[model samples]
Target: MPSFYSKKDLFFQLFENQNCLELTQLPYFSDHSKETFTLVLEAAEQIAEKSLYPIFREMDRQEPQLVDGKIRIHPAMGTIIRKFGEDGWINAIFPYEEGGQQLPWVIHLAAGFIFQASNYSASVFPFLTTGAANLIRTFGSKELKEKFTPKMFAGKWQGTMALTEPDAGSSLSDLTTTATPASISGVYRIKGQKIYISAGDHDACENIIHLMLARIEGAPSGTKGISLFVVPKIRLDGAPNDVLTQGIYHKMGYKGAPIAHLMMGSQEECEGYLVGEAHQGLKYMFQMMNEARLGVGMNAVAIATAAFQASLAYAKERPQGRKISEKDLSKPQVPIIEHSDVKRMLLFQKSVTEGALALLIYCGILSDKIAQETSAAKKLKMEALLDLLTPIAKSYPSEMGVKSTSMAVQVLGGAGYTTDFPVEQYFRESRIHPIHEGTTGIHGLDLLGRKVWLQEGLGWKTLQQEIQHSLDQVKSIQELNDLGHSFEEIFLKFNHSAGELLFKRNLGPEKFLADATLFLEASGILCVGWMWIKQAISAQKAISSGALEQSFYLGKIETARYFMEYELVKILGLIPRFHAASYPTVTMEKDWF
Candidate 1:
């Protein structure tokens, strides 16, 4: 069973006391899990520390260029990524039956942080391939899976999820990609233009599997009419080697990760095979998309985490600000760390990144439960929890991840805005997340809109009960008692605030909907406060046990305390705003803008 206290010792000290992380265990962690996962995280850190981070600045400086309607990525990056595929990095979460590491999603996500933090743009295509590949495996026939799984898992063929169009984006029901049955055996004739597909035209792999969505003939209109297919850039039968560059998109960030505007079946037919039942594409695609939402959230957190580390290092080394107690203005202004405001920014960044990571990894643990639990009832509960957490997991961390990155830039001042440092790049990369899987508002609406209604509200109730349990546990631990009490107050404030909003005149329109973003933020903060108290309790135990890294443990306790003091303390404000949730922003005239 996962303790309220154990994970704290293993989190931040991942680099130094990874052995301690090794010693730590999750209730759902299989016997082989620690050995299997820690290396993934370590390897992720390696990629971030080595390959991706070094190139991030250059990546921002030189966005992917569209030359003759094709994208040629950084010279050695294609090879490096191919090496990543060869190394099983892309296939960690694939089923072992599929020639993958068969690791849990959380571990894959933990490792993902390394890649995304280092260079998100470069990893987008390969990672998206994993999602696309899994979609095929889940919904496609055995023939499709057998034919495509190996190469995709092995990174021989990359993958892309194409849902957006010139007019349809967010509204899948309104998409126009058309599909017609082919005269050929087991094939669907696909003809559509898919835009903004990452790795859509990359030369990293032999074939790019386009999971294109389209409307079947005489089908129900809107989302129900759409069917998904495994449409490859090049038709592959017995032998699979086609590196055709159809078209490329010039993008804002992630320049190294090529984006494409594909015109499928315009030439020789873009042969595709149906994955799931006709008109059930949206359901199947959501599996990958939901997974990607979690991935995107973690990516945002990782980027922010990297910025925090860099900013922390810079604040300590940059000799600009003087000590608050220093009488001498001439005292060479010690490092920026001396300034209370700078420290506050650093703390906020650290609080979000570390706290976000804690929640993200634990969500992974919950995933393991949802996947592995044998009992139907228990598995059902796990599924509900998973559903409840996904929106917050995707929405909360992503917003704060961007917030943290921006603050990192603030820490660097002018240098942060320029290409000289990578924080600005972190911000730029993070800026894409709100739109990556779903916008913050969508996630917000999901949380308030759908999550509250799912499983008869069992998931939300379970989460509230769990937080209550943690709140009680906080009172039991002497070291964490004060923080616990403070958190309890914050928790109650948040709960009361949410209740007022719900009871208020019906959560008015976009203005109230806009509050949905802040609602996600509050929920996420409350959730992490629970995680932090648990972590601090563990840190207290680690210190009691005469651990060598008491300083590290102490830092964990301190950071959690700081979070309670500042971040969690802010939850008190939501009460007043939430009371006005029923108001409508639609009252405004269109011409007012």
Candidate 2:
């Protein structure tokens, strides 16, 4: 079997580049060390190799089916979920009191990267459960937790976040899902439909727990009235709830996990236990949503990484046309890897997958820091920074992952388009990410309209300071000074463009956000550029210290250079568009099309 991911690079990003071991210093994670982290990652790899990757293609081929009103998925999923739970993966990052190891979120995310790279579809089940269960642990009542979490944590019950409805996909405020009070104090009758719910309905587990969002029957309209509920497919009394698996979506990719369309209370029998307080559903769901956003970004990176690996392996073994300079007819064709274009494509994939992984890991580190931080002021600062980067972290990888995986397909030429290679599946899988968690456009608005202005722009300022700190560190290193200067210059230009656009907020929401997606793209590039600079600085320091892996360090430096020269420079082109006074897109008539 071909390698789907690089453990060496993952360790480099975690330990050498990001210094994730520093997280162990916090009391919350003090019990853990590098050795334990390594063991966890090794175990994840063993599981991925043994259970996940071997069936990667098989899962995709045999997509889930709605059989006799029950959604049936790959047979291995039950065993996989049980294995994840048995090995403490679902609750791995929770506090010790919660029956967890107090592991760092960064390490857990890193392990998730390995599994996702091995098999994107199979990997979704556990993480979705993790996110849903986390919501319950964080906001659910003690009784709710007691009744639901043990089974979820034990893999006997699957957890899902059911938010999207047919009429309200991204517009949460418009969701019409209704909840009525039940005879019981904390229970409500959930009467609404939820669509496109991932892992929403699966027979692999005995029961399905839905972290559902709904509005109370007489509550105020819009988002203010929204509330959260814990709706189960089966009642606690072992009787069926009215949560029906109405249908199943046959997706273009990510076929292993069923995307369920469900109807609740059709028989007026669905019982929903209220989670936390009423009228704060959106607020509580954000915790899971934001985490899911980062997970979506990582999912994109992992699939692209898998595709890159497949293409890379094929390039090394497949003999193709001779170099342009070779004229002799008797000369044997060289491996495709020898070609310049192929190298460029491979470099693009590497720069994207590695750079994006670094950014996601950095976000994970921020999450860890925020969790352990005691000082209210300091925690707010970190929160501001993390909030600002969330959309960028989610959007950049998702948007660029498409191009990166396409490059993988291009590198393999005709073989990449066929089922003979895995790149095509990866290509299909990569398309879902930009739409998942939240669409790229939704995140763009979140980034520019909301997150950028968070805490009166403290997040933006924090990001600038962080980037400049990296710049300061690299400026003194002779090997990296030029690249450092290049990034600084481009970043300044990007920042100036952003400032000019922000100044236009007074013009109206439409005018300001008409090009928000462009702003998002530029910000994503600049952020990834900063990540690359950080990596280059680490690689340069290691090289200066005479690290044994000379080639690995050198490759890191070259990939960083490629990103700075090629990918990062594209931000310069977007800078001018930001300054455009009259926006045609905003003013264009609806009937013009």
Consecutive 10-residue window with the lowest summed lDDT within model 2: 490-499
List TM-scores for all candidates, in order: 0.91, 0.99
Question: Model 1, stretches more than 4 Å misplaced?
Answer: 1-33, 237-247, 329-332, 504-514, 581-584
Off by over 4 Å in 2: none
Look at candidate 1 and tell me the lDDT of residue 304: 82
**lDDT of each structure?**
0.75, 0.93
TM-score, predicted candidate 2 vs. hidden true structure: 0.99
Clashing residue pairs in candidate 2 (N, C-alpha, C atoms within 3 angstroms): none
Candidate 2 whole-model C-alpha lDDT, 0 to 1: 0.93
State in Å the error of residue 243, model 2.
Answer: 0.8
Give candidate 1's total backbone clashes: 7
Candidate 1 has an lDDT of 0.75
Q: Which candidate number would show the highest lDDT if scored against the true structure?
A: 2
- Indicate the residue-level lDDT of 115 in model 2: 96
Best-matching candidate per TM-score: 2
